[model samples]
Target: MSLDLTCPYCQQPFQLAGEQPGKHANCPHCGKQFPIPASEVRLSRKVDQEPVPQRIAPATFWYVQTEDGRQFGPVTEGQLQAWYEEGRITANCQLLRKGADQWQWATDLYPDLHQIGEKKPQGAAAAKPPPPKQALDRPALPQSAAPITPLSPDDFPTTGAGLKSLGPVLRPLPPGYGEPRLHSFEALEDRRKFAPFMVAHMNRPPLNKMLLVLGIANFVVGTLRAVLYFALFLGLLGAIGAVDERGDERVANRAAVSLGIAFVMFVLNIFVISGGVGLLQRKEWGRSATFAGTLIGMIIQLTCVCVTMMLGADGSGLASAIWIVLLVLLLPSILYDAFAAATLTLPSVVTDLEE
Candidate 1:
């Protein structure tokens, strides 16, 4: 082994060249020769070792916490995450970024939350962490659900720690089961306040599903109506051909009028179909077009019903009443238009489309 020795001439340290016992060696520092002791202790080994360097934690720009309106630090992502896991900071602690105006939750800022614990603390030897988190002797299930009382906004915990602790206990559930969503609370509140037996029809998000159904339905209905209108137009044209205006001006004029109506309807249906396609693509214009078409359809259908009843009723009160009643109950086209209008007007649907 090479010997780590002090050069007696210069009092400087240097390693000897060879592994064998030597009598004389040159001091690289002073450039002077020195005697190597024959039976001195070997002060060096094959491998040279040095103390590992202490790693410094890197930090980012400053952030302000919302809870106490106090700035946390110019801290690394890992350190912030560690504070969160330690419950020194809660999810409700909204942080305003260095150059930003609005504040966002820590979870929103840091997605790699649970993994931060795996990293060694920066300067772990010098820093003193908070009291070691302890396990409760009592069961964790009940505590997981902090609020056990009936659903009431008044009774709800408004504090961060309280709210953080409030949630359905994590069960050893099978697949497709997990933490109860926050929306479920809204359902519970409604049920308790309204009808106990009424179950929430929609627990999942409605935007995508409704958009798909209504968009496709609009497309299909518009196409079918267009085909019907075109067929009627063709039939009218044949009538006009069979009975020339010269032969029967009245019949030909009526046929011409019906054909024009059919043509206009077909053109409108094309717009409706385009609107439906737009809706499927989640365009604002599609929602607007579909909504406008729905309103026009409702108006036209109602007008037709009124006009037909007045011109054809002939004072048959019973028949006219029955007709109006049936139309009100079973006018699928107008009713569907109204329904579509309602869905499109919903704030959730509108907001989703904007997004």
Candidate 2:
């Protein structure tokens, strides 16, 4: 049933079908985004009541948090019914399945889900007997304006006129060759094989091995700088020993405070190293947090460099130059990776199934 409902945004009526809940059907008049819910058609009813199941007229969507703390899309009432019928998901379950292969839909249902015990082993499915042969009528040959040539009975050497015992059975032309062909079965098979491989290649992971290598290198260098800073602070404290004993005490205390601050930086560096590498590996949390943290770090580093230059800093030029170089190396890469990760398409899942 398609219901004519006015889009709130556009004030234009559009057709809403029960099967298209949460789908992006729009107003033709104004192009305002609108979704069709089952209730809009006034046709929702329990299709099956045997298991105490009820199908509501319209389903509302809710954001669900998975076990791993990732938020998924809105789920609908029809989807909820299907999920309950199938054992793959549970009602009100907090824990969602692992593996990027699992799905969370606008409705709690897995529309792509297979019916239980429906899948046959590939080999067994392939072993079915071949289909029967189809008869083909011989096409009439063009008549030549020449005397017809005929073969003598001795040319065939048959015991009965135009008859012979069967020597071998011929294979059948496939199902496509049978009468009332709706479509070519051979063309369908050819299309299926190439379609998936091409799509899979196109949708392959955003990060190549090279990006992962760069992530690892970034982590290592950050960790090394943190360690070197700690050593530098200790050496600075030692240098203050040449001053008067009381003055030296004050310098040593300042050095100790600086070392403590450097230690915090060390911890952050270690976090970046691990988190960034994890993101490159495509771990969900790793991908989100690494980029998020690195972005913050980039801002902080730039600010620190500005403040230091403003203060007429007297640090060793080599130390400052090394930091500048490291900052330049990492910040752009982090930003690029973050943008890429966010924009990458949701990995494709089976969107439709044939009966």
**Model 2 regions more than 4 Å off:** 1-206, 233-245, 248-254, 313-355
lDDT of 2 by residue, 1-355 (tens): 4556788886766565545655667777887776666564444333332366555334343333432334443443333233334332322233222222232331233333223323322244245222111212223223334442333444322254433332232334444454765658876677667797555446565565544654675576556655765686666556556544557565566556556655655555665677656646555555444455455555555555565456432442235666567556556644643443343323431111111
Worst 10 residues of 2 by lDDT: 346-355
Error of 1 at 115 (Å): 28
Off by over 4 Å in 1: 1-206, 313-330
Clashing pairs in 1: none
Per-residue lDDT over 13-96 for candidate 1, one digit per residue giving the tens place of the 0 to 100 score:
988767546677888878998788755434444244545586643434434353444444544344444554445554345554
Q: How far is candidate 2 from the true structure (C-alpha RMSD, Å)?
A: 36.7
For every candidate in turn, the CA RMSD to the true structure comes to: 21.9, 36.7
